[model samples]
Target: MTRLSRWLGTAGALALAGLATPALAAGTQAGTTITNTVTVNYQVGGVAQNAQTASDTFTVDRKINVTVAEVGNATIVVSPGQSQAVLTYSVTNLSNATLDFALTTAQQTGGAGAHSNTDNFDTTNAKIYVDTNGNGVWDAGDTLVTYLDELAADGTKTVFVLSDIPLGRATNDVAVVTLTATGREGGGAGAMGAALVQTAGANTSAMDTVFADGAGATDAARDAAFSARDDYTVSAAALTVTKVSKIISDPVNGTTNPKMIPGATVEYCITVANAAGGAAANNVALTDVLPTTTTYLSSFGILMNGTVTGAACNADGAAGGTFASGAVSGTLASVAAGAARTMLFRVTIN
Candidate 1:
C-alpha cells in the first residue's frame, strides 16, 4: 500500500507512551502480556490504500511485596511454666505474582514490645506454624510450616508463634518476639523457591522482579520482606508462706501470759500471701504435721481463711479443716493477688 504519511520505525515504537498501564493499584499481575498496536491510514493519488499496522508486546514484571502484622492489639497473657502459649500474626502477599514467603522469628533483647510493654524475658521452645484451617487460632490440625507455600497475589495467611513460659518468670514480665516474611519465587508446589532478585536497569520483554515492600519492624524497605512484633506477658501467682506459734494457756498459768511448757495450749498460724500484680492463686491447700511432742487438740479442730490482726490470727474463720494421721489439712478455695489468708490450729504439749 502507498502511504501518504509514514510512521517511525523501532525508535518510535520503543518511545510509545501509555502502552502498558498498571491494571490495579496493587500492581498488574506478573507475566501478564500487554500488546499495543497502531494503524497508519494513507491515500495514493486520491485513492484509498490498505492500512499498515505495527504491534509490540511485553510481560508485566513481578513486584515483590508482603506484610507481617501482629494479629492482636494486646500482649498475650501467660502463666509461669505454661507451655504452648501463642502469639498470632498475619502474612499478606501484596505482590503482583504468587510467592513463597520464608518465615523467621526473633526475640527482642530488653526493649519495648509492640504493645509498648517492656521486654524483660525470653520465651522457650519457640516455634512457628501456619493456620491451615483458617480458624485464626492455633490448633492441633494446623500445619507447622517454616515458609508459606504457593500464596497467590493478594492472599493472606494466619501464622502463629508458639512458645513456653519459663517456670520462674515474674508477674508482668514481658517477652517480645518478631516475625518476618521474606518473598521468594513461586510456582513450584510443595517446594520452596529461590530468593527474589530485583531486575536492574529498565523494562524488558521478559518478566522481571521488583521489590516494593516497605520497611517493617525489623526489616528495611524494598528488601522484599516485612516484619511485625508481638509479646507474651507473664501473669503468675507469687506465693509466700509464714508460720508463727503463740501460747494461749497452760495448766498452771491458766491463759495469763502463758509460757511454752508441758500441757500448754499452742496455737499455730500459717499465713499464705500472694504478691501484688500477679494472678490469683486458686484451690490453695495447706497441710501441717504436728510435732511428736505435742498432742492434737481434737476439740478445737482447725480454723481456715482466718483474719490476721496485730501479727496474730484471730478466730474469725469458719469451722473448716480435718485432723487425721496427726496432721492438719485445709483448703483456702482462692487467694487473690496482694491478699493474705491464714489457717490456724491448736496443739497441746505432751
Candidate 2:
C-alpha cells in the first residue's frame, strides 16, 4: 500500500472513533432516542483541531405500516349447489422501505347473523393469486404466488382470493371469506433472535439486522393488516323431458294398435318440462334426427308448440316451425318454471 493511502485510511478511522461512544454501540429500536456528535481528527500540515458534541437526542420513529382494502364489496349471484366466487384486494406497502408479506384467509369468525356468516356455506378449492395481466379483473391466466414479494413503500398490488361454494346450499345462503396479510422473512420480519434481513444465504453481518425505529427502545417485529371479504348466493331448478309415439295409419295394422308396417305414418312427440321452483331455462333448443328404418317427410319436418294430446291429428302444426331436412334443429323460447313445451314430427316406416 502507498504511504499516503495508509495514512489517510488510519486518519479516517480515528475520526469516526473520536465520535464513537456508548450510543454508537447501542442497538436501534422503536420509539427511542438517539444522539450524535461529530469530532474531527486530522492535521493540516501537522496542526490540531477539536469539535463540540451535541448531548440533545432525537426521537426514533417506527412507521412500518401497510393498508389492505377490498377492491370492492363483491357479492356473487349464483345458482344453489353452484360455483366459485373470486374477490379482489389491494395490498399497499405504506412503509418507507421494502417488505414481504404472507397472505392467509379465514371464514367468518364473527358472531351469529353477521355479514361474515359462513354457516350456510364454506369455500372449496380456496387459493390466492396475483394479477399479472394488468387488468383489474382476475384473468384465467395469472401468476400464482404464496406471498406478496418485495413490495416497495407506497406501492400496491392487485391480488385475488378464489374459492368455490358447495352445492346444496340453500337460497339466499351467504358465506363470507376474509383475507389477511402478515410480515414474513427476508426483510422486516425475519426469524427470531435477530431481525437481520438475509438477502442470499442467511443472516451474517450485524448490518443486515432490521430495527423498528432503527435503534434503542425495542426491536419488536410487527405485522400489518389489510383485510377484505365477499359472499355468494344460490338457487336451483329441476327440468324433465318426455317422448311419446302414435301411429297414424299402417297398410297392414289399419290404424288401430298399428304394428311397424311399411308405408305406415308415425308421429313422435318430444316434450320438455321445468318444475316451478326457480328461474326459467334459457337458450332452450331441441335437436334430433329420424331413427333408422324411417324417412322424415321432406315437407312436414317439425311441429313446434306447447300442447299436444292423444293419437289424433286434431291439432295441426299451428306453431310448427320451418322444416330443415331430415335433421331437426332450432332454438325455442325460454321455458319458464312450471311451463312445458312439445314438438312433433312425422316419419314414414321404410
lDDT of 1 by residue, 1-350 (tens): 22222234333544553364534535668898766556787899999899887765667788888988888778899999999999999999999888999999999999788887899999889899999998888999899889999998889999999999999988889999999999888549899899888999978778888898999998899999999999998898999999999898999998888899999999889999889989999999998988899988988878899877767677788889998898899999988998889898899999
Go through the candidates in order and give the C-alpha RMSD of each one to the true structure: 4.0, 12.5
Q: Using lDDT as the measure, which candidate wins? A: 1
Instruction: Tell me how candidate 1 scores on lDDT.
Output: 0.87
TM-scores of all predicted structures: 0.88, 0.51
Q: Model 1 off-target regions past 4 Å?
A: 1-25, 42-48
lDDT of 2 by residue, 61-92 (tens): 43455556677654666665444467788877
Model 1: which ten-residue window has the lowest total lDDT?
1-10
Off by over 4 Å in 2: 1-55, 63-67, 78-85, 94-97, 106-119, 164-175, 185-226, 235-237, 242-269, 274-299, 304-341, 346-350
TM-score of 1: 0.88
By TM-score, the best candidate is 1
